[model samples]
Target: MSKWFCILLIACASAHAAPGAAPADDAVQVLNDKSLLNQIVELQHNVAEKAQSKLSAVGQNVSQTAYQVADSTAELVISSMGFLGLPYRRGGSSVETGFDCSGFVRAMYQETVGMLLPRRARDQAASTQVIDKKELKPGDLVFFNTMRRAFSHVGIYVGDGKFIHSPRSGSEVRVENMRESYWLKRFDGARRVAGTDAAATPPKNY
Candidate 1:
């Protein structure tokens, strides 16, 4: 009888230990799964952060490029303005001496933008791209039929529908408005130089 009671007690203890051991093993497995999920989430976050950083760098590069182009264009226009009021001389081509209508345009382009334009008003118009008046912008060449021929006179377009030009042999360089009856009647057309792109692009060889 004593041997049988001892055996029965050992069997009960073993049964309870088995059930407890199963729950402990399950707990450990759950903990490992949670740790793995956390690691995956952290990895995803890191990848997103790196992608954002790269996009920001590209945005800054584009902004800098746009700024440089605008700065260069503004400088060219301002330099042309400084030559205002210089006396006009027939066939003259330099600021130190004087300038004709075409000479003035050529000198301004050369000095400010490093571009050499054709020497005569007619030739300058023929060499450039013809654009409608509605699409005109500063630095474009504006032509006039002052001598009954297309592009007999040429001028640099300033903003606000105004242009700077050497009017005639006795007149000096001056800003004139296209709205004026005299200019409006004689308006020939607008032209753009070879390197000035209508579309946005990096500065081209002038």
Candidate 2:
């Protein structure tokens, strides 16, 4: 198994400490076997094949930013996974300083895809292309009304009904099930950042 996969397993092992919560082994299986990792590989392969064929046919007409390939999206997901245990900090956006919900999402997009998103959760939601829940793919943005306001929190969707984010103060960056009651009720909407290239649109000033 890959080193990152081991790290993910370890993180999941420690993630569910509550007495009635799902078993750590079960969480590990859900995250690795049933969800994110496997889905990423499949998504990458499928998109790579499609991109190759389309590129051969259209040549220069294809805009890299206009249509994102799965490779970049997979990279984004893997990159975010590397920070699984990073601490949360309000208004923070770095390893040293930690990250907030929106800050974590912004940092991932900026670092991996060269896309600079709006700094706050609401602004990020307003700026991106609104997408249906059924249309959500790896690397898309998922918003939540955690603070009793629409789009008050944000995370990077990593497939299989899960998303990764810096949850709140005292909570480190972690992946959570969107199907869970708390999150399910608060889900505001989903959005997609269309570009994989560095020339994505500039973030609007908040």
Candidate 3:
């Protein structure tokens, strides 16, 4: 009878030990779940950081572009203003002497922005895009056919429907209105050199 009782106690102890051993497998599974959660969190953080970096780069590019446009426009205005009232000489191209229509434009752009426009006014017109009369803005080159050619003369737009130019041999550099009867009738077209933003907003009538 004592031997039978010892055998029954051993069998009960073995059944309890089996359940305790299963906890080891459960602990390993819990650890694996924690590791997966951590990896997912890390991946999400990296994606967010990359997105923010890209946005900041785009913002900086836009800011730089705007600053460049403003600076270029200001330079154009200043350079054109300096040439005001200079005597007009046919085929001339330097401030030390005088300037013709195209020569004045060439010298101004070269001095201010370091860009070389085509020598002749007609060539300058052909080299640039043909912007509409309504799309005119400061820093644009306004062309004319005063000599009965397609683009024999040129000027620099100074906003407010006006442009600065050396009108003739006896005339000095001056600003004239595009809305006037004579200028409006002789208007040939417009041109833009490098560094001038053609996409800039057009000036409105004040």
* Candidate 3 residue pairs in backbone clash: none
Worst 10 residues of 2 by lDDT: 197-206
- Among all candidates shown, the one with the greatest lDDT: 2
The lDDT per prediction is: 0.63, 0.72, 0.64
What's the alpha carbon RMSD for model 3?
34.3
- Model 3 CA deviation exceeding 4 Å by range: 1-62, 198-201
The predicted structure with the larger TM-score, 2 or 3, is 2
Question: Which of 1 and 2 is the better model by TM-score?
Answer: 2
The residue-by-residue lDDT of candidate 2 on 30-119, one tens digit each, is 455543566655554666566666677777346343246455776687677766767789999886688899999998888877789889
Worst 10 residues of 1 by lDDT: 197-206
Q: What's the residue-level lDDT of 11 in candidate 2?
A: 60
True-vs-predicted CA distance for residue 148, candidate 3, Å: 1.2
Off by over 4 Å in 1: 1-68, 197-206
Per-residue CA lDDT of candidate 1, range 1-206, in tens? 23442343234323322222223232233223433223223323433454455457777655444444444444455455455556678998886677899998998778766789999999999999998887765668899999988889999875557677889987776667687999999999999886543222211111
